[model samples]
Target: MKQNITDLSVLELSNLIKSKSISCTEVTDSFLRHIDDLNPQINAFCDIFHESAVRDAKLADAAIAQGHYSSPLHGIPIGLKDLTPTSGSTTTFGSKLFKTNMPEHDAILVERLRKKGAIIVGKTNTPEFGHKGVTDNLIFGKTRNPWNLTKVAGGSSGGSAAAVAARMVPIAEGSDGAGSIRIPAALCGVVGFKPSFGRIPDVAGPFSSTTPFFHNGPISRNVHDSFIFYRAMAGEDHRDPFSIPTNSSQPTKPLPPLNRLKIAYSRKLDYFQVSADVENCLDATIARLSNLGYQVEEVDLGLGLDVEECFMTLWRFKLSSTYGGLKKNELHLLEPTVQQLISEGNKITPAKYGRAIKVRERVWDIISRLFSNYDFLVCPTTSVPAFDIDKESPRRINGIEINSLIGWFLTYPFNLTGNPAISLPVGFCTSGLPVGMQVIGQRLDDTRLLQFSETIELENQWRS
Candidate 1:
């Protein structure tokens, strides 16, 4: 039985290509046709390399004919988040200042993908410097949600998530400094995986390379496909100051039976208001997990309200440092909000940053205890569903007045602690907006978490 080319998984496509069941050009053409048909409304891509993609596809076919297949990603058409630089492509990082900026070489992750025989389709849209929780940027406009055009796709990796969700591409590259990848994956009903901070290298990260919280990972419609893509992109890269040196030399392994596994679930780390839709979806998931015989208990890590301040402090400091390098004359080209955020960042003194680090250390210490007794922690990816495109986050969650839009997110804490977290499509809200359930693992336990995610994915049958 032949499956629809557009419906095939990345691994499935690779297998077909290897077996001569389908040619690389045919697969590339199928995706390009979808890109032409869908990208106009979705705005998922900042640039399109249709001609190059076809050229590469033909080459991929020739390589396979001669038995030179590079990896599972060979001939796979993939999108790079605009924040990622490719040798010949303009990577705008969703800002005006770098709209014309072209790098001398592909970012380390891009090089990794190319070495695996993956075809660089084009650049996906992203917010300026991937600063905010949403996807709108001053340079490339906005990326609309494929599920609901009027709503947001969740961002900084919004375009990558949207592209995967729309079937324009089976997989794409995305980074999560603070939930950039997972947030959108939840909204688009795709799988977003943030491997441990250094599991994937950011040797050419647009912002400061020293920040451990910033991470690179993959986004796909399913966990298994993402596993294949991530393995190709992850490894030790000495150029990246934070890249991990651990020998994770093998592919992800399968999970054992779930009967003895324990997953601790938390609704809110403390007591932030949650929308009814998110709560209901979580409640049902909890019930389902309980029925599956996994020990699911409700617990809190006590991350504290001050943790938000700590995260924001570190984030702003990083952004402020990145913008400080801009030539004074070129400063005017930046987005106003970015300017404001950087201004706030500049105001943070070293003393204040040190204080924030103390709070972060406290969080790491307190949360580390949870792992002693539980294998994983499950939580809502976002406090609310995808809100209005032009706005920040929902003004209120569960009728409680929310102050900052980032306040509704639960992803940053993990980034601060350098833990591995993944967002899977658990279900949807009454409004048809997708709700994601986050599964976090201990540091360096990415393979286990991925196997766990695949278990849930098989049980839930989640797909766009």
Candidate 2:
């Protein structure tokens, strides 16, 4: 019975809890038990709040008995990325420097989730300051993929992705500066959604930038569960100056039916070397969409200028500015890669940074115009499948060398453009590792993108 609860989606669990078919205490206990048994192998959680979660579960049961009902997430166990602050909980961002740091107030998203009756079970692990795509830090160690423990689980949201894939939790919060959520979701065989910039409130912190390039969104096993969590965490917040005012009337508008759609599929965007397995999987996905009455065409996204150079400059600048005030001793505790990036950022002159910003805006303008002709853009989430956990980055993809971190981060451009993107499991590689297809929509069209993803999943029957 406990095993059965672990398989249920957030919507499914919510229905059972509402109908009294399962008590909140039962659901919480089931998750807690699973985490206790499995977390040792996966390293998905940095800290567990078992006692507080049990107490919250009991309170939920009492409310249900008294005829009080909360939001759809009531009593569902969820994990928080250690980057988000949780009042009274040790919210280490996968760093030894702040291992004992605890916040007196919850982050805006955490406060919203608590109000909606979701019980946070623990803080999931992340790379130090979420600086890299792989989830390993000097403090909490590495988070292994549930499917194949030896392979890497994409990060900085690796722990959240692993937890969802392993059924330790139904949903989790993940922040994406550049494919952090989507990369792990692809590797872990789960659903990852990055809502348009400013759609979800982002609380400011040492790593947070005033620019709306970074976003916090939900990662779940299914589309509806992601939607439910997204709706709950979204809306205007005075604390985040970039948060947009969501019009209630807009959500009520019926989604435009996705029939006879035009999809632009790019296997290798501007000569990007892709793995044969990923190419084959993407071809199959395009066929499926065509069978569902859509037009799929091979399009070339001629993005002028060095996109990697521009994005990295901006990214490193943000990191440097965000953490520039740390003491030298505290800085020494950071990962070597992080320290290297800070040094590079420190060397970037203001004039060079300004030029990079302008280049980003020009690229966005071009991509936006391209979307006007196509309903959505499609590409492989990553150029290659999950690699060995011990390797820092893949040395080669399809026999081509990848020299730097940004070389493998093909999905970062969309993040820079603030487009709504989702990574859906398409197929697996010969190594038995998962491959994912990225469905990208224009900014502020998150709901439509989600609806289209549901169509794709249903047509392909892609369930883990």
Candidate 3:
């Protein structure tokens, strides 16, 4: 069977474009056509740039013809999350209030990708202010999971994950404030990597500058593609004081072999309730790792229930700080969750907020100690698979009611600790939904994490 151009991975398409076996225009057209055919059904894209994409593709081909190859992303079609501001393009942030808002300059990551010859086809949908786990907004509606349209695509990066899963785009950018990248990647059955905080410069104004839990990352069908995106987006920028002060050049130091690494895993993180199907899939993954000569062990991560409360407190605080002033004037325009968050956040005293910060440090201490003993930590990415798109999240997992937006996800802790984490599709649930296993590495050790994920990818051949 002849492979579809849209089905090719980022590296495969890059190879073809570099070899002149395919033109950038041909690749861009194929993806734009696929998006046209699928976006309406899934609501994955909020903005489509047909003319701009074509022009950029032609420019990429021209550069290649002149024997100037920029990087692996040269001539590749990619999608940016709607929250990412792009110059001269509508960046709604998935809210009606900003429906017509357009930035005068591209985000730091967008600038880097464009310089490397990546063609932005459109802006993918996200939740209003990216405030929740599922992707739906008053402006763009909900994004459906490509696996099963009846189920949610997960968010706030739901659109990026769906586009990659449906083969509309081989790679897309995602931001994770609280599992926005990994949550949807797990639900959509693609690879989403949240590098250690500051690895990718997130110069998104005051809100992004002070947040320790937020990170910008990549979503794709495979680990190598995610790595390619990571390499391009990582580097120091004087504007982002938190940005890592490291060169983004390809690393020459080799990572340790996977077989020699020590891995610690928790089925439910010692507190959250996990569904039977997700637990079954994770168990199978542990068995596979054991068979592959990995030293895998189950451990009790003594993260008290206070961790969840502290995370929510900080999340609400961030939201209120950014949008509190609008509550008195534009509250009607904001989504119900965002309004509620802003309301609750305004009531928190400085003392309460400071106490939450203290808990955050304690949580980090627990995670840092675990990393000192183990090379990696693994767990179920989410407690359940993709659920009904109509609701924000499953009302319950294993019959325990989920009261919070990001509670069902097992990804937020890593975000809080500033560790690198990647979600790999492990298998599927009986309901025909995909299951994901999250692999977490120590902070700032992104290269080792990527190499480990690639090794596991080759072993499972999950895409097969």
Among all candidates shown, the one with the greatest TM-score: 3
What TM-score would each prediction reach against the true structure?
A: 0.96, 0.96, 0.97
Per-candidate alpha-carbon RMSD to the true structure: 2.0, 1.8, 1.7
Which 10 residues in a row give candidate 1 its minimum summed lDDT?
203-212
Name the runs in model 3 displaced over 4 angstroms: 206-209, 248-254
Q: Rate the local accuracy (lDDT) of all candidates.
A: 0.86, 0.86, 0.90
Tens-place lDDT digits, model 1, residues 1-464: 36679888898999988888899899999999999999999999989998999999999999999989998898899999998878787888888888899888888888889888898888999999898778888777889999899999989899999999999999998999889999999888999999987888884562474353888899999998889988898888868767876465675545546887888989887756677899899889889989988889998777677887888888888888878667767778888777877889989988999999899889888768888888899999988888878776676776687646477878888888889999999999999989999999988889899989888888787763
Ranking by TM-score: 3, 2, 1
lDDT tens digits, residue span 14-121, model 3: 999999999999999999999999999999999999999999999999999999999999999999999998998999999888999989999999999999999999
lDDT of 2: 0.86
User: Mind sharing the TM-score for model 3?
Assistant: 0.97
Question: Residue 362: error of model 2 in Å?
Answer: 1.6
